[model samples]
Target: MAQNNSAFSDSSVHVDVKDYYGKRLQKTADLKTGACIAPAQPLPAFIRDALKKVHPEVTARYYGCGLVVPECLEGCRILDLGSGSGRDCYMLSSLVGEKGHVTGIDMTEAQLELARKYMDYHMKEFGYKEPNVRFVQGYIEALVEAGLEKNSFDIIISNCVVNLSPDKKKVLEEAYSVLKDGGEVYFSDIYCNGRLTEEIKSHKVLWGECLGGALWWKDLLQLAEQVGFSQPRLVTASIPTIDDKELQDLLGDFKFVSATYRLFKVPRGNTKSCKVMYNGGITGAEDVFQFDCHYTFKANEAVEVDGEAASILTHSRFAEDFTFQPPGGSCEPCNKPKVSVLLHTSDCYDCVVLS
Candidate 1:
């Protein structure tokens, strides 16, 4: 229900929103991404591995607001949303190995062209005989229409692009449908802690730029469930601090968090029951923290953190999103993990339930 007043200026019908900034060209960032692009420059360990096989141009032109690569990508079909210049795709190409396939999808023509041009060079650089990469010109929401088969991909990855879609709900549904029974969706995109009202989301420039169009974290979790995904776990988040007092005044409490989330689409998670494991004080915690908690479980449940039992429900089956909390114990805080409800058949295996 937001109309694009900034980009289109038509101000007539309320459009879902394609982009707030405008149509993407060859560049990775625009007005919408703003300072978010700065995060990519640091390049996490996972990101470094992904960039190793890509060309300098690819890295230079890359515009991602989140980290998408984790260690679980072996022999998996990886899909990169808004895969500009095929940077992330090529990174996955090597990680998935020769047996796997990496598909990069973006609506930008110039970016894809550059990506295609470097195909041969990347294949050689990564030591692959026949590059296991492909690029398709399509919007993130139109992936199924782009000739992609259903229930196919093993891992679906997107870096700060999903927020640009006009139809966020539709995108989530399509994503869930495409993953294999035990597959996953590991992505990093901008998510606002509070609501993104119709006014802000309607701004064509913001939507196109991939800001003010972010899904509310709470709404995202609900959508994941509505579309059949478990609770999403936070992999890594860069908390915005007031290191610079001036920047804090302009931004307020609003912070940018680039988290790698995992959602398993299989029924295996339901079988997991509650069990307590005590690893003592947080594995590497410099301070002690108390968590108010509760929970129990059935049988065959495979989720239990070696550290604190209270946070077992927070462990993500997807290798990347798993983060440790309080030390394992039999206290009330150790009852059950949050959103640890594993669904039965007709769904995913390692999917996390984001509360």
Candidate 2:
């Protein structure tokens, strides 16, 4: 595995994160900035019900920026990167069910201990014959070294934890290596308008708060391309407020948003545009399947999709959920309005309007 040789050592960053989440912060209430907490939104009924079953102790320690749940999760093997307190892992356990499995990996021992402490409790609560979830102690940037097989997981999720890594590129690389060809890294993390200075990056409090280590939003595009993943699809975003006056002044003009994006590991090539209709079998999104900020497929309605979207629909786990037809013959692309590009320069903190 490649290590980041910068003014700050990778080991030092790991130590700081462990100290912050393990010793300094006792619960979500102990967090200094709102960047780690996701903004409120109406969730699907099934998701809301699943969350209510998670252990209160585990939910209390959750500090994620946004919900990382993706559709078509019935029997898919999933991995959770930086699965602090196992909050997501336990919730996902119910979604994946008895046949599917969820593995959570976190570096902090204290968090891991708490996660394992409830293993039997959650299994009984979910009424499972046996436990389908397991917790591993490992770093996100070094998953292969941590004993995870390459091309193994159907999906991987991270919530507000990617920014804490000193080498964000390494983290993406590791995630790409572990995912199956049709798999995806669906995650939510803190993103800033522009890159921060080294002075801000060095601040332990700022980094721990998930502000200083945030990636410049544009940089994520380049990183995904470099890592050989499909273009990131923006799902949702919200502005995170820094309430502390001292921290706000220290941040100056820099702005941060909690954003969720999904990057797929599909074949690298251009696929022709096609007409697709959702069959609508996925749980929670029965009537309409919202693919991203730009695309929403109503059940049985044939909509023309771009090459990238077509490829994702046909090649991934969702292939079974939709039917596809070639564009421009019987399908006729002109019948429906083409997807529009929404400009979001003014609402930088709310969402990224993809072109």
Candidate 3:
């Protein structure tokens, strides 16, 4: 195939991404896992059930980097960026229920066609009366160009697809634009352990698919800030295992980390806070959960009488959401050195500010 030689052409960009992914999608069973870290939780049983009900041909062509929407989404209007073959979108459609909708955007006609063809089958399998998901052919960077409105969706989702875009900043901007004021853009994608070089960005096979042009973590933070969203929150993590024999020579044993992002457009000047007490329940739980999403608190961050006291946790950057007077009239004797004094820092962002 010849190149499109337009001013937009980077000379390095090659091939319709659809053909590249279509082949890769078809051959995923034996495909080498090149530093692609999968999600911690397995795909939801509802989704796996739906996939099984769909004909084998459809499942054979389902290829994606990770499941991005593990949040408790009972009724969210979700927009999936670069939703190839509508796999994730259908899962969201089921989770969001009949009142909700899923919109999938992709640039490849072949992939979009395949996704659209399954609309009836999926709707019936999920026992929905109408098609709750739609597919649009376009780029993630220019989502508004395809008729999306500002501040409309409850949840904006993406799966290992943003790295394929030539204009990721614009993609971040557009994502922030379409989200309702409190809406969040939840996504999972590949990130290099270190910063990426321009040469890696231009790798034809890598960029043509979704592996080569991943963003540096710091750059992603800056873009989220630029887009008027709070800093992204990480909910899960895994490391990618590379398999490219040739690229291995160039990028030797480089680690790839996969993480989920929850970026929100916080309300103006309104800082929120949550009093977190570790119940030793969540992952790698300690005797108490002391770490804030952004920074780790020193031991005794939360005042506990016996490793299990319920006191309002306070941070300098956060307003005490719970207003409780001490057990006495002021600072109570119940505090009897049972808890240590903790100092809070002022360098907190608004995203987690609403903790």
Candidate 4:
């Protein structure tokens, strides 16, 4: 069972979120803090072009913290948790092509109504013979109850919304339950330096703004392990500036950053280190494929990888994109630890997993 916060029940948090996102927030400009704003980074040309095709209204209402698009999305089924305004869903709909499908789930009826209203427009704009995206009204913590089948999605992506949930562990558990073996959950959201006080968690406005219920970055590591997913690989990170004086005062020494992470659901085994080379087939990444912050594989160049990374590349959807040499077959022995401890410093822009 999912545990709720002592200060607020699950139902109360849901109500507060619905009221804030549905009734109070009229547009992206209505956001009081930078926590929900998209990360400031240059996107690839392909992604920029896809964003251009989305309806202006959908883009205008987007409140996500970072870009959730992952590589090799050509024919995969995707699920967007808290798909507000369906911005990421619509963008993904184009990337997934006509043969693939995308599902957007949200708790607020108003957001779902808005997301559903533009289905026809996006399909026509993408030149698809049929619509490839759909929206569901449900909580992220209870995906099975919302009718999403087990092992149904190839990838699940959420943006800036998980922090708003009262039970973060339940959300991860549900995500793991719904993904196929070797599938992944690639998401971006707010993370604080440490666990917050009850007073901070009890603040309605702070909670609604995606500040109050933020997770301590370390807790995410334990949660992923508990839910049977691979250790999270940090993809990108950037500090979010809190401009509100009152909120800043309330959060005296605590700091926040919008970070993206990728966790895989691969078969459990003691994978050995191997040398792998990219074949250069993924659409946008024809020359180099960056698996995470630590490893980047250039086309046709054999790069040695650790055991965990070796497992992810071998078992996930990216398997066909690379050629792997058998472990110990002319490959250097890997001396790194199996578990990489993530270390976050107060002044650093991003956290790194130290092997």
Number of the top TM-score candidate: 2
lDDT per residue, candidate 1, 30-58, as tens digits? Answer: 33344346352255465566577689878
Tens-digit lDDT track for model 3 on 198-290?
A: 677666666654557777666778888787876565654455555667776655544556656667666433433322322233222233332
Q: Is candidate 1 or candidate 3 better by lDDT?
A: 3
Most lDDT-accurate candidate: 2
By TM-score, the better pick of 1 and 2 is: 2
* lDDT of prediction 3: 0.60
lDDT agreement of model 1 with the native: 0.58
What tens digits encode model 4's per-residue C-alpha lDDT throughout 1-355?
A: 7764432224888999999999999899998898899583568999999999999999988998887999999999999999989999999999999989999999999999999999999999999998899999888998988889999999999999999999999999999999999999999988887899999999988998898989988899889889999888877777787899999999988888788889999965679878887889788889877666667667777777778888999899999998888766653333332222343222233342111
TM-score of each: 0.67, 0.93, 0.72, 0.91
> How well does model 4 score by local distance difference test?
0.86
Better of 1 and 3 by TM-score: 3
Ten-residue region with minimum lDDT total, candidate 3: 308-317
* Clash totals for all candidate models: 37, 0, 4, 0
Q: Which digits, one per residue and each the tens of the lDDT, describe model 2 over residues 98-203? A: 9999999999999999999999999999999999999998899989878899999999999999999999999999999999999989999998888899988999
Candidate lDDT values, in order: 0.58, 0.87, 0.60, 0.86
